[model samples]
Target: MTVPIEDVRAAAELVALGLRTGARPTDANPYGRLLERYRSQTLFRDTVDTVASGLGLVVLGAPARTGLVLSTQPGSVFAVRMGDLRSTGMSADEKLIAGLVVLGVAAYAFPQEADLDSSEVKTVEVAALDKFVRDSIERVLAVPGDPESVDGQARTAAELYRRTAAFRPKDRQPGPAKGCTQFAVAEVLGWLVERGAARQMPQLGASTFQLTDRFRLLVADVAGGEALEAMKAVRAGQH
Candidate 1:
């Protein structure tokens, strides 16, 4: 069967739009049209999926409103590693804390299963998120358990986080700090904004952010993990 070149071009264009950081379907002209085709035309949808797969990308979702959401495979050139989330000269503990910060943000933004399924946009404040993560870690650490098991590892991480300060002095530099959870959370949130997972809402506050559909898709994909489960449980207990 001869495939139409126009369909291929359209599929490629849609994939390119998906790859652009922070690009939503409603953001511009071609995105809305391409995404509409993806939803209405079977051939075009398959072609778009094929194009994404050929490039080692996963088409996570293409909801009518959110458009095409893509994630890179483990070894794909577009894959983002934990190292990519770190700044220059970060220690191992700080890196681990950064990873936990991400999980905290996800859990805090979507505390319930229904929240993840809903179309309602959720917002988070950096300072509040930092406090929540630290409190959750402390709660987990307080539980009596073996010191040589998975919970023990979690406790160790909690201890490390507990040692970190909630915030630094006002005169400190404007970046992540090894001893400040607030700065670390801010840095991680900034990275998420750049990756299209979240967007800053300055009107709400200087450090407030609203989660994006792209982030929802990503978190829903990994929502079953143990860490997220624990965090969700902690978040649930809070309110």
Candidate 2:
């Protein structure tokens, strides 16, 4: 299902807010507004289970591992993963990888991933994943918009991610993921990373991510009251 470009921009901006503030899914930060918006819209209700499974894969990476590398709370991996799969046909498996890519980007944005003390992620092919994520962001941008403004696109991406994460089950395992107890969010994240829409930093924590710079620039281009405010909040956090 295609969404308004402005909406996409708004959504991306919201995620960026979370990134800037180091806000976790469980945090009561302003990012919760994005979640509230999606819940009100009732988007991605049909295939929530699939998306959850995909996100679970992202938490574990391409190959299932003994433990997650990221330091997110128990349900966080699921939120990030599911958020990436919003509104896309990308299956549960595909989304799982996508969520992983989000985690990779998050790690890159922050310095927390380096602290993970796990051997499950020892190798990282950065160049390959970077290219994949860039291509995916471009495709996401290719969607037509009535206004074609930066705010349109940024909101869309942010809200999409927020809704995907919010709709995911908080506890129950949606399905088996690579021999692990995967959820829809993980499955969706896995799908995106594998499909080249996003990239993953496997050597980093499950919460890590690196959205293509192209996606970042697009997000930077948006200029809405709420979007700009969110950006300000992020910038303020950096200091």
Candidate 3:
């Protein structure tokens, strides 16, 4: 089963915000290290393409050809590419939902790459995707038990980190903004750092970060190195 896209988005924002300004896991507790891993010490070498593939979805860098693939399980959405092979028994609505989620995520991951923004995603206009993800998990668990379903949520969460976990020193620096994008990226990277999936690169400068061996290992463990290579290949493929 597929997870709700909103949950994925919220998780990204939560991780991002936590990294940028620090996290308070509980209301009573002032500060929680839930995202301490994302600080300068850790990194997430995995790219959005890697994450998409990890979820058993076909990934393409082209937005015009990508779409979301929804599942009955919570956090089961996939970002499929246009020309990729289709999964068996995938419904039309499921494909539509998945397309929306993938597109939405891509808009955020590749801000400059896409013409869309966070506001353009249309999966959960009436209801927030985060609430849907949580609620869907609750419902699924009540009906029939599936551990993979639950882990799918975690995978989705991990994908959140994967999407925005790039080591863009140019983009990581503090820039003038009302909402704070650079800070958010820093915060997310901080979480990856804590998770042993990322590391800071002093050579890049005070504001930059790069991936470590541990980060590469984590991506391979979860999604395989094909996706990782795809993302890195992006740089080499560049003119």
Candidate 4:
């Protein structure tokens, strides 16, 4: 099977484009076209896969597929790519929401004693997340605080979090254009959308998102083990 130099270059560029942007190109894009060709051509698949592996990436879309999921390199080593984080402009509260979103999705994606081959990802409503954060804040606020303060100094991160737990999620952070909880949820989902890891249901607007297979595959292990187990326990009322 003869291979053209142009095809090789095109395929490499397709991969490079995905890594740089953290998103896949549309099917009609030239990079996407060449990517499909390289994947389908038996002779070229190995070549492309080899290049992908060398670059600490994995080609996750099928040869016949239109959408590609150029995922990060597997394993904990690539668990949280610094480059991906830098691209996201998430504040502290939003970061917490992002972590919760993963746990929320993982609860359904990796069920216990299920026979399904692929993970069954669950959609999370923004309100549900907001309520969750709000509930936590409430619980923390209810707890009696230690009167001792270090030289009557400023509150630490944990202290601030505890204090804010009593406030409404929207009231927690003020001065932002959007309510803190709402903005955080939107930004977190937006980050996932940019990574091709999740997509918002147009009808659901900012309310809900369907976690993509890319998310199940990439985020599973990172969100797996005790974290997922805890979520499952909570769902079953065992926690």
Candidate 5:
């Protein structure tokens, strides 16, 4: 039997609320009053999942990794891979390289890849990866492309580098980065937090974030097989 349109609208609202607020629908609280009325957790979850999938995302726990998807759009906060990072003057080549640099750092530092959830990652390892990522980004940006503009390429890389600082936790109060070569890896880590994939831990002169269970579950499907290899190749470009 077909479901009523009202039910669909309510479900959509619930999905938005749950993702934005990170509240699971439950029978007791008003959080999921509709789901409670229906008396079905599976129904509510599946409905939310369906909505997320339609938007090229997958809702994990409420408010966590709220809308994690690899795709980028016109103005997605997820990454710079989407439309022009700025209004204009940025070349397609710059966009592609900058995106790859960000993507590489994210993939390598992924809890699934680095397994930060189960083990403590050495600070040296984190620093090394950051170096590799910055070098890779600069290399790609520096490489001459069709109708290349050296000054434009350098400027793009510099902008990306500056934006990298945008990721440092406001609380940590990190000082200014020396230059575009800096990782500002914190940005990727912040992205992880936004996606509910990881949570920040106490720092001892170094940064670390604990991976969440949902991260493991989601990556198992999206970060394995061919997708994993492709991600690896993207990261390898930095090497």
Candidate 6:
């Protein structure tokens, strides 16, 4: 079968758009036309998949309304490491806490299976999320057993969080500060916004955020993981 040169060019363009800004079929002009081509033409879709695979990317799916979703394969250039989320001058413990904060956001945003399935927008606030994570840590610690039995990362994050202040000092300069739960949560949320996983809801509040469908897709891929399960257990026990 002779593959049309136009199909290859279109496929490359579509994948490029997905990488650059998350190509949506709902988008105007070329993006919409290319994505529509992807859905309608098997050859074009195959070519797009081929291009993505060559670059170590996986096309998660392309829902008409949501557009093209992509994920990086292990070692892919686009893969975001935990260290990438770390702020400058952060200690190893602080980095762990950052990871915990991300998990907390995911848990708080979609605590139940039904929530994940629904299209309803999920929102989170920094202070509320910090409180929830701290409470979750305490709940886990309260379990009767050797403290060592608890997940090591969770324990470490909890200890660090406990030692940290919940808010920055009133007299301190304005900006994110290390060892402050509010700042930590805010930083993580901001990072999420930058990565297209979430968006700030300025009308709701400066620190409030709404998770995007992209984040939902990412979380769904890891919905069965232990970390999420533990967080979900904490949420379930509360209600």
Q: How many residue-pair clashes does candidate 2 contain?
A: 76
Candidate 2 C-alpha lDDT tens digits along 1-239? 77666666555544343233233233254445554453455543212222334434211111111111111334654243354445546554444444434433333332222223223222323333333333334333344445345445444554344333223234555433332223333443455444332356645755333333323322233222333334333423443
Backbone clashes (count) for model 6 = 0
* Model 6 agreement with the true structure over 1-239: per-residue lDDT tens digits: 87788878888888887775434456577878888888898888999999999989988876666567789988999998667875455677777788778878878877888877888888999888988888787744443434444355666777788888888744557544656888889988888876777888999987789988878877776635455567777877777
lDDT against the true structure, per candidate, is 0.81, 0.37, 0.31, 0.52, 0.46, 0.77
Highest TM-score scorer: 1
TM-score of each: 0.86, 0.25, 0.26, 0.60, 0.47, 0.84
lDDT of the structure predicted as candidate 2: 0.37
lDDT of 4 at 150: 22
Query: What is candidate 4's TM-score against the reference?
Result: 0.60
- Candidate 2 ranges with C-alpha deviation above 4 Å: 1-197
Tens-place lDDT per residue, model 5, 198-239, is 666667435556555544544443433332334455455544
True lDDT of residue 39, candidate 2? 42
- Model 3 spans > 4 angstroms off: 1-180, 224-233
Two-way TM-score contest, 4 vs 6, winner:
6
Judging by lDDT against the true structure, name the best candidate.
1
Candidate 4: segments with Cα more than 4 A from true spot: 1-4, 20-28, 63-66, 74-97, 108-122, 130-183, 220-223, 236-239
**Worst-scoring 10-residue span by lDDT in model 5:** 63-72
Instruction: Report the C-alpha displacement of residue 51, candidate 4, in angstroms.
Output: 1.5
lDDT of 1 by residue, 1-239 (tens): 55699989989999998888756776358899899888888888889999999998989988766668898877898888667875575777776777778888888888788887888988999889988898788666665557655455556667878887787755565644547888888888988988888889999988899988889998887735555667788899888
TM-score of 3: 0.26
lDDT of 3 by residue, 85-142 (tens): 2334434333333422322222222223222222232111111222222223232223
Rank ordering of all candidates by TM-score, starting from the highest: 1, 6, 4, 5, 3, 2
The local lDDT score (0 to 100) that residue 216 gets in candidate 6 is: 83
RMSD of each: 3.1, 21.9, 20.7, 7.9, 8.1, 3.4
